[model samples]
Target: MNLIGIFGTSGFAREVGDIALAQGYQPLYIARDQTELDAWSFAGTAILESEVEIYREIGFAIGIGENAIRQKVARRFAGQLKFINLIHPSATFGQGQRQIVEARQGMIVCAGVRFTNNIQVGDFGVFNLNATIGHDVIVDDFVNIAPGAHISGNVHIGPRCWIGTGAAINQGQGDTKLHIGTDTVIGSGSVVVKACESHSVYVGIPAKKIK
Candidate 1:
């Protein structure tokens, strides 16, 4: 009977909806406005009223500079807010697994190192150990990252992109998704100098599009 409302309609929000359903929560997608958010009436004591302590436990950080993200998350946290933590059943966390140095709701983390807040991770994404991702990183859905990959701050990765082992992108700066296109494969040990195209294969130093 617990209804979870997801705030964005695109990308991360959509993925969060899927994960919410998988976890047996009634997931509802809401627009970026609070008027629309409050209009969706609940018949019972809303989780929003009871989950303030939980919200205090989690935090928010958007990798992009768009002011819209801040506005939306701020509205959600205006009163009491509830965040979600969604880990795959097969994923390992804490001691011998990915130690949860930070915790939040609507997260789909696989085995990895410490994670902080304000990170927008896409659905069904996997992170291997010794792999480091910095703050404000926007990871798209279905991203498959190999072990030992070091992604730096303010980086944006597009949906369904595969980051190869030891492959590194821009230390998460500039204006871009760092833009790894959908279904693209990055060969192991490759270095991506520029944003990659969708469904293409890039390899070697500077990661040229070979396929």
Candidate 2:
């Protein structure tokens, strides 16, 4: 069994652990501290590599709070770490299915249906349930795409972005490369058509870029 160590013991971490086990990996709970990690390593338990690779593998960072402690720990242990991917049991991926595509060990794909080559989900990104990602789209790391969102084809979402619930990107015609910058927020039920810069909040039709 591939022993998978979780960085945190929070509810989110538990949820991730469940997925890890379902994916045929052995899940071990580890505190988000260097001492605990060292202890676990000393105990001959393999630490899960989830720092740079998770961020680098996926487009964004999941479970990253404002505090820098976790980041520091991850950086310190990245060399000996092993990252893993978490996919819901209900999720499916195959040929000709209209949905998003996450890279190898990339993105947290929740239960949902996706099209063939519709969305390119970056490493450590998240797609909540029941969301539809259209074809030829790019989603960067640390992105949070809420449930029931409809993303059309040829759209590009940057890293650390959040696409809110029931939002529609590239709804209807006017096919273009819709870009959302890093750390951007798309409000609920919003429609985006144009390109967005980093750290912008967008809402309404045509998606005005707000600070």
Best-matching candidate per lDDT: 2
The residue-by-residue lDDT of candidate 1 on 146-182, one tens digit each, is 6677666667777667788898876545654466777
Stretches of candidate 1 off by over 4 Å are: 1-112, 175-177
Alpha-carbon shift of residue 153 in model 1 (angstroms)? 1.6
Instruction: Output the TM-score of candidate 2.
Output: 0.68
lDDT of each: 0.55, 0.62
In model 1, residue pairs whose N, Cα or C atoms come closer than 3 Å (at least 3 residues apart or on different chains), thus clashing, are 60-118, 61-118, 63-136, 84-105, 84-106, 85-105, 85-106, 94-98
RMSD of each: 10.8, 6.4
